[model samples]
Target: MDPRYFFFILFTLPTLLFGQINENGIKGYFSFDICEAVDTTDVIFSDYGGGVSGNIIRQAGAMNCVMDCSIRGNSFSMNGLDEQIVFFSGFQSVFNTSDFSIGFYFRPDPGVTKMNLFTKAEMCADSASFTIDYNPSSNQIEATLAQNSSIRTKVTGKLDPDRCWQHVTFVRDDRNSILYINGEQADLATASTRINAKNSSVLVLGSNLCIDRFRGLIDEIAIYDRAINANDVDDLFFHPEEIINRDTTIFLGGSVQIALSKNCADSYQWSPNAEINDATVAEPLISPTATATYQVDMISSDCTAKDEIMITVLDPDDLDCTEVFFPKAFTPNSDNLNDFFRINNPYTIDELISFEILDRWGSRVFFTDNPFEGWDGNFDGQVVNPGVLLYRVRFVCKGVEQTQVGSLTLIR
Candidate 1:
């Protein structure tokens, strides 16, 4: 047996934030950490609380996988030759054609070409299998769910191979199937036919029936019985450090609103909850007397990530703190991408007295007192034309009333 040619399969969970992934619709959760030698046979367990576990069939003489541990922990290392993990139980509901989601983290080997990341197909026509493959040559992810080769739904998305671990999720919401790479929608396809994989068939990771095996470290394999929404996908794909960039200062006794990029988590816990108006919410207003680190534990489905911001309370007399950031431009075309004119960092302002927008003719087009509230490019029940608009904002920063005038381009 070539020591480097042996496969390792683990049935234990890694050190998650709270515990194992406890998502409601999760049918199968495989945390490929901690290897156990069981009668010279490697086994894999679907550890979604009380889900059924299965033995994993591996290629001959594959070494016990324990290399390049990413954030998700120990992973199965495939040699791209023949090593694969075969799970043949409790995976039928996971391949629901109507609404389902499947995700996993993988770090591909350098220069890997066409290789299968997941497959659950049998020789039988009624087996109705699904497979996710990565093709580095085209830099795309090709996926297919089929009742047979003749009746299938195919989808592909851009997949740029990175040296670090990357997340990929395929979500089937009704007839639309969206492929998300690292929390963002990479591609979408409408499925013309319904397909579901039968439980009797084996679910194979790292290789397809065509013998195109994967060459990478795969971990945190998960299967959802429902189509996990974009928010859940974001929570799973992004870590806390990747999202929170607020390590800032605040005037003593002044409150600041701290928030995440998206507030879609199931629950939130702000450590040292005192001095915070609402610690359980995604965005919390905090008035701290002393300098301290506030950490928020964001929990969504089976994933948990936490980010902390060190609030350095400073006296207004010792520092010059009277500046408000305004966005130079905004687009209100209703694409849900930057469609509102809002303050960039409203936390710096203690209180926004009024924010007013005026047309070139000095007509009041929009007015609001909330720093978070934005102008929707509407005036007198009609969307205004794209043009440069003047803005006058009155806000209190560090107990000092400040007025700022600026012009922003409104893009249609």
Candidate 2:
């Protein structure tokens, strides 16, 4: 691998990185290539991590094992009868966390219903478990994380597979559960639940403990200890090279041109065409009024790669010359209109530093630091004689402070 590839993979943050798997938080990676030897019976070793090897146990059906690099390189083909690949060790601590991601590429056999694609659960008793399955009854794929047979979060989405390779991933990031299909977010839910898989259960692929056996070709399976971001998922789905610039930032009212490397893709489709000059072109000029994220699908004959760029728009806050008004006069006679001596245009003020009202002798009769409170033309529990009262207000507007002094006439 070129040294530049490391630089691109380590630093660049995008929706997808092409050609390589993200190794930042990877716990186990199974490519199932020809290079991985089967030492005992049908045990296939994981390429990057040990102790999570595939122990193929075929109770019935003919065996089909082959390597195909075009579609995610080498695959584990299942015959759907009673065949499964079980990993009997080293996954208890991997899935017993608050953040994790599991992804793979699979091409299911046509008409396969109620098949379990992946599972990690204890069959003896109801405990914390995780599973992903395809149901023909609902024509949907469901991903569930549960405890004691009770679902913590279950996300379901449409997955109409026509015997073609498709990528699917389930992620748990803190309280958020996300499911991604073909580099796009399919479903999302929020739940801060713990998945306690600290039992004698093991991880199984292509079946759920010998039940609901999956008939398909599975490849490029990966497990991450942390939540693999959408960008990482895209990179895994459609491996592409560095074809565009990193995310950009611009001031409000400014324009930017997002361009791709020369000869990256045969066709382009940019989303959120609102503020861009052209959405069908590789390089479009955009002048968005607010901060927004733009995603573009680079389509070629081989694969469709997707990427996104976030444009952060900054608008500074400066003080405006609109002053807050103090009522010039008011009547305490109980008429609703102008009955209290209060401040007007209070929306223009952000904070009240100090507000005080005093009589002619300079003695404080009413005082409050609250901007919403005002005097009601009363002093010593009785309405003061109709006379002029002094008011001093110190307040802040748009983070800048200013003081205003004026006289208010009280009427009976």
Candidate 3:
């Protein structure tokens, strides 16, 4: 066995070191590969700390096991029927803690109906018990942390079988007791005190007593005395080595391209439906006139993951739109150009406070509050005689208000 194949096998992603103990404070590790363990009972399950050697026992009979190297190199396979693996009176103090983390990778077979993944309890009572289990009916992984049986914090998302080969981690600390799936935090909340498995005389995996046998491949199971951060679990989930955040800044009317990585996801959905060039593709061009947050949901065969990028559109503050070239001609005859006495390029302006046109006698012939709209050679649905029109305009620029007076001729 090569020294680099420690922890069953090293699964690297783009030059990243996976399963580093000093980085995460790992205490107990179970890589169920017979070729990796030095001392074992019939070369079955071995611990990273060389302690699975003493915690081996059989309840009904020995479970027929096999080595599978398809996922992350190698894993222990179980038949979800009458197979059981019991542990002696060990692994008690390893789990007794107020803050701890348990992480592993597993793929469940269809025969696995309902079973607890990891636990150290005497019976059905939930007090000194810490366990993480799967519920087929809900299609979710639930965590019970030193629970009272009735109250447990749980986070659920649909786990289709195609996405079954996933990494899972559970943690309980002073601030939060969280469950992470595929490096994404999963538990929704059922909090309890520190676990009390110190006096538990029996411990087990795959199944308990006579039933609840798991049918799947499990690899790189670990127990830590301290809580690990989301990044640690993310590495366990085979997350990309680089931070996925693609946040950027842009001036008003400026656009940027954002893209998603193509590692394992099959489909994606982006939100708000604003100024995206192509919403269905892995990359899209966005040009927002205002600051906006864009959300994208990535769906794989087994799980759904989400991420977001905020586009900080440059503020239109301090922008001056006070200049308007009032045409000195007329033509409501509708030839399109210079047809109405209007402000040139009103679209460049942010807001129009007031715009009014008066006759020579100071009588208001046309009144408007829109910069784009102007007098169409009409006063109250009546065509006024062609003459010089007096106008007053007030507009806002960068939150500042300014006024301008101008005159124009209206031609028929």
Candidate 4:
């Protein structure tokens, strides 16, 4: 080939294969961000390495998963009788044999037994050509390939899937198959075989060969045609993303109204949400059933801030809502300190429908919708007589509507 032709071939190949291999060597990726989904019916996964799009097959079991706030994504749980994720070859070939690798993030639930995270095997084959899994009996991560009844290459890394997130990676060559957890090598062994693509070979996620399905959270799956290095793995682990820090407690099946930064943030958003009555306010209310992190995205004119508030919802019987305080009397004689009779636990009340003060004859004299406001001893424009006045406070607490009735003394 001519000198100019040689240079053209080198430059053109990478550009043509943009979806296959780039600087990072990623060919297929399923961040499972859930935010990237168009809907449940039209499942999709992006190809960050090769740029080729793929489809996810909800083979068996509900696609329900938990939002893993630790790494800012999702961890799918295959607890349903037969829940699993599959990528048919009709979507695209995501794995190859020579210098290939597969990886993902996972955290096993409590009492986990044996759980498989990723697999791609031909139907009716004795064993999957490729798979990465976690075995509680050994407290290790393992990879397997080749014929059925084949032994898995184990990598010893005793991780508490119920407590923290773990990143798992597998790099394959002609012989040794290396496994990594959170960018650190956990184990190494000579892989019995490399995965070969076939028409019947389909990609399975969160399950083991479509049997003995996994029951844990899995996310951020990717495949490469070449080996991924340790530095690259570390980079993948520490990639930049928005950070939100929070810790909150609520009654089981209860809600939380998180206060966003009121310092000029123009936009607000909440995610991994359920039972959300509003999302456009500085303080949106969320009621989550599980112990998960709630994220709020606050955007200002120039910058945006992301915050994560971890919510631990306990059983309804475990809560004790006892925030009640009020003064017995007040004198609105311009004496500032004792002029107003304010309501206690203002923040605890979800809605202060009304705070009413009535005369001895049951006539409403002073009224307010703001709980912070207090009576100023004025009925219309005139000061009321110095005597006992009735007050009725109506508010919602922890989803229960309540009413507080009492009397306060008014003095000149």
Question: Whole-model Cα lDDT per candidate?
Answer: 0.70, 0.68, 0.61, 0.60
TM-scores for every candidate against the unseen true structure: 0.56, 0.50, 0.48, 0.45
Query: Candidate 4: misplaced stretches above 4 Å?
Result: 1-23, 34-53, 59-70, 73-77, 89-96, 123-128, 147-156, 160-163, 191-199, 208-210, 239-412
Q: Report the C-alpha displacement of residue 116, candidate 3, in angstroms.
A: 2.5
How far is each candidate from the true structure, as Cα RMSD in Å?
12.0, 16.1, 18.4, 20.7
Error of 2 at 95 (Å): 1.5
lDDT of 3 by residue, 171-279 (tens): 7665457888777886645355443444454556655532375666667676666778876776566442111557876668799777554333467667776799877
Q: Please write out the lDDT profile of model 4 over residues 1-412, one tens digit for every residue.
A: 1111000001112333223323455556655544333454333333333434333335322334455332545545555235566654323343544677776776565454677677776653555367676777776777765544553343456553222456788887555678787667877777556444333566666654545567656666766767777766665564222332258666576877666322325567778656667766667778887788777665554335566778876664444444546788888889567888777546456678889989899999988889678777887798899999889888877788788899998877
What is the Cα-based TM-score of model 1? 0.56
What is residue 215's positional error in candidate 1, in angstroms? 1.2
Tens digits of per-residue lDDT for model 1, 352-393: 999999999999999999988999899889989999989999
> Which candidate model has the greater lDDT, 2 or 4?
2
Residue 320, model 1, lDDT: 40
Model 3 scores a C-alpha lDDT of 0.61
Best by TM-score: 1
